[model samples]
Target: MPSSPALLRLDPTACGLPRRSLLLAPLGALAGGCTPGAPALQGGWVGTHPERGHRLRGELPRTDGPLKKAGVLIVGAGIAGLACARELARRGIDDIALLDLEDEAGGNSRAHALGGSLCPLGAHYLPLPGPEAHEVNELLHALGLAREQFGRTVWDERHLCHSPQERLFIDGPEGGYWHEGVLPPPDGAVALAQYRHFSALVAQAQRELGFAMPTQRARWTAGHAALDAQTFAAWLGAQALTDPQLRWYLDYCCRDDFGAGADTVSAWAGLHYFASRHGFHAPGDEAGEREPVLTWPEGNGWLSQRLAAPLRERIHTGRVVMRVTEGRTGVELMAWNEAAGAPERWQARAVVMATPLFIAHRLLASPPDALRAAAGHLRYAPWLTANLLLREPLLTRPGAPPAWDNVRYGATALGYVDARHQTLDPMPRPPLLTAYRALPTAARGELLSGSWQHWAQSVIGDLAATHPDLPGKVERIDLCRFGHAMSMPVPGLRGSAALAALNAARGRVVFAHADLAGYSVFEEAYTAGVAAAARLSL
Candidate 1:
């Protein structure tokens, strides 16, 4: 078993990131190369468009605008906000309004379309809803993704992710290449045994403690809750699970879901990744094959779009909610309309703050000490996603064909997801590959201060290792940098009193967002929204 410090310093290159460049070069020079007149990287940058959100840090110019009246005002149009609005409408509450700072309302679930291909900016897939997830099941049924057949929910076949679902490339026996799934190659018998042991442990945890979506539903006994007291790496050490391959796979799962490594993530949160889906079985499938996932070319952006469709007229894009004050009869909100170039005001009987917790702290007026302390304890992990439009398919050596998800072992980035993998029609043109990387909390400063060109170069260079001709096959590369991509479920964070305080409603304002769940995921965000709406309805 490795010491805590040893686990903490797993490996500098474990994330598959390139070494820091010695020379600091300008954006133009770095992107197009040292040679002048070379064409710049074909794509531009897109994100949540942080300008208006940043403006919340300082006071805005006072405006004499009349306050608009609303029965409910939801301050955000992300998944949580949209879910709140949708739930309100479902309950026959129509006098509600939703606002978002981004031009589009999906938040990180936003999608981009280029040359007839659609790709995701952030979240891309959702696991099959558990039996206890009633709201989620209902939402899926409403969206035509699911239906009741003989008292069992049946998911749409077309929407399910097709196989050859995932593959991994590692330096090992078969010319340093292994195919099928993200697990370690079969050559590592000891690692495989450890993985099996770990799986049994997760199953036991699920049976005993109950790890499932909407985290609020999980049975948090003193024994299970104790898991949050230690780091995942520490737990691994205690179990004597010292296989390097096993550790790497576990670390990858942490980075992929929580945007942090095992050493920084909580044992409970890490185990939740496995236990949460313990009994998740797709509709009409009893063979116990891999659980099916609902996905589209645009990823969860498809679900986001559907959630926003009914509330389109009620959603106000580019409206930044700067402040929220609880009044005797209702809640008052001051916002700045980027499109109108002026201040806007709203008064609502109830308000749901579906924004991130960090933003909620800034917007709330005279927040309670508990809320403030809870917000302070919350940490966010940054992520970078680049969509590369290729003029041709990636050149492959003899092995499995291009899978929907391609992972490179020992690389900083989590390889790339092929955006065209779900296309029904025959692709007559090149494909669009969406590459993803979750920057460790330590690298957040570097990502923020670095130029887009530098990040772009890092992405291309990383992929070049897997596909040698990747550079020349690329035509456009659009980069999406999420400074606070997902909430990091560090040790002592999940199931903590701080998180409970953060989730509690304050006066007329109800909090909603994935962060409240202590681990960011589609189900948590949606559930948070629904929970907030239920509170507002009451």
Candidate 2:
């Protein structure tokens, strides 16, 4: 793991995890470079990461009293803040306080229980960590999750992802690993070849372990950053890898990773999807395939809950911090105490603002002009995920057997993950699978204002393209929209000075967000949080 700053080192009370526990959290942004003429919309003219506001069930309570005098004040209850708080608590430094605008601590990791299944409100899955990704390993181990219990990583048949891992519904039939025996004829062969070729290229990039020049803050291998200079479309064009079928696959990959199409994501970011991964088990553990990613029905919210366990009592929710100014006394956090229904202040020697960059912009109280300029250039893509409860298993399209992540080859974003996939109960009435659809910003205007019925109808309509009776089978539809889900990793966004400037802390006031990490992945959030904490510890 990269060296985190000092602020993250403060220790909390004995009731929580060790400071070391803070070091590992689940395990787990953009720049604008344009020529003088107001650059043309290079790729798809779409906002990549947008937000879907959280629906507060009731009015929040406000607080006026000082929770506690602390050496550190961490803002936001999302994974980043929780992880930081957990780490600080473990450190034996009890003088700490955490605040968030939401009444809950998970932030985007929030979930809802519906029809016997849990649905994720924000992030869903975490990629297994690489060898260098020590932070994740530490976190998992700290959480009491032993690699041995996971069965040596090859995903033993018992622990292995069950029979139907994935499937694609084409025309009228199904084709995927679940239906490996039912491979589609020659046409299927063509698509497979395309996938093979692209996979090979990504694999080659991995072998090379490419690193960006100067090597300071590349998201993945340096090699991946070099690829950032080109758009995925341009990269594909160079491969002469253009076929309508292949295009759909590429689009699916981009939609899954960037919440947009291949044409929109930077080629480097797309390659990182495959290349940055180095999945291998122990020496003797038939590690043919990488470790099977472990997830709960509500996706990453499960992990967030696990991490929050140790800090439940310390977290202050619905407290929107509006400003952070350092003084001779320490750091002053000017914030709104939701519970008390009034503006309140907090004092700490150091503070970490773990909220999103856009939110931080307001809290920082007049950031450097460059940071402000970059914040303006950065764009977030909004996403809407629908977790539908089905009355019964919908008819499989002849050859396709539904698996965990059922993705439509050329349809809306990547399809849904079967919530019951992880459940042991093999009864006929299994839990319903939730479909997560990411609507493009252009479509956001239409989707956001629409009712749940409208969104549910849209989801069923799209699935109907392949599964004719899908709409009738759905018993309930739960909707959660992440308005600013993630930042788009565009070409110029990779190395923009503006993003770098936002990360710069002008004395006492520090910035923290998964966005500042420049990549919206679990590790990025955890690492960024720790980094902010480390800086304060100094």
lDDT of 1 at 405: 90
Name every residue pair that clashes in candidate 1: 15-411, 15-412, 16-411, 16-412, 17-412, 172-176
* RMSD to true structure for each model, in Å: 5.2, 15.3
Q: Model 2 over residues 1-538: C-alpha lDDT tens digits?
A: 1111111112321113232332221100000111133222111111111221231222333435454566778878787787677766666766767887666668767766776667666677665555555656568666554355555633223333455666654442122112221112224445556656765676576567653211224445355556777788999899877756656666776677677777777887677665566421222234334435656667788778887777777787766665666676577776666566676767788777787776666566556675576577666777777776666676655554667777654456567777778667767564466676666778767765665555555565555444544544555566766666777777766666776665565445566666775556677677666556555543
Give per-residue CA lDDT, model 1, range 1-538, as digits (tens): 1111111211122123332431233334434433466456677677657556679768766866657888999998999999989988988899989989989989889898876789999888989989767778889999999999998888898998977788887653333443566765433445556766776677778888888787888767886668898899999999988877678878998999999899989999889897887532211225335667888899899999999988999999999888899878888889988888888999889899898888888888877675687688788999999998887676565556777899977766888888788888774456688999999778877877777777877787667656655655666888888888888998777777867875665557788899888878989999888888877633
TM-score of each: 0.90, 0.77
CA deviation > 4 Å runs, candidate 2: 1-69, 148-161, 173-196, 209-226, 278-291, 500-507
lDDT of each: 0.78, 0.59
User: lDDT: which candidate is best?
Assistant: 1
lDDT of 2: 0.59
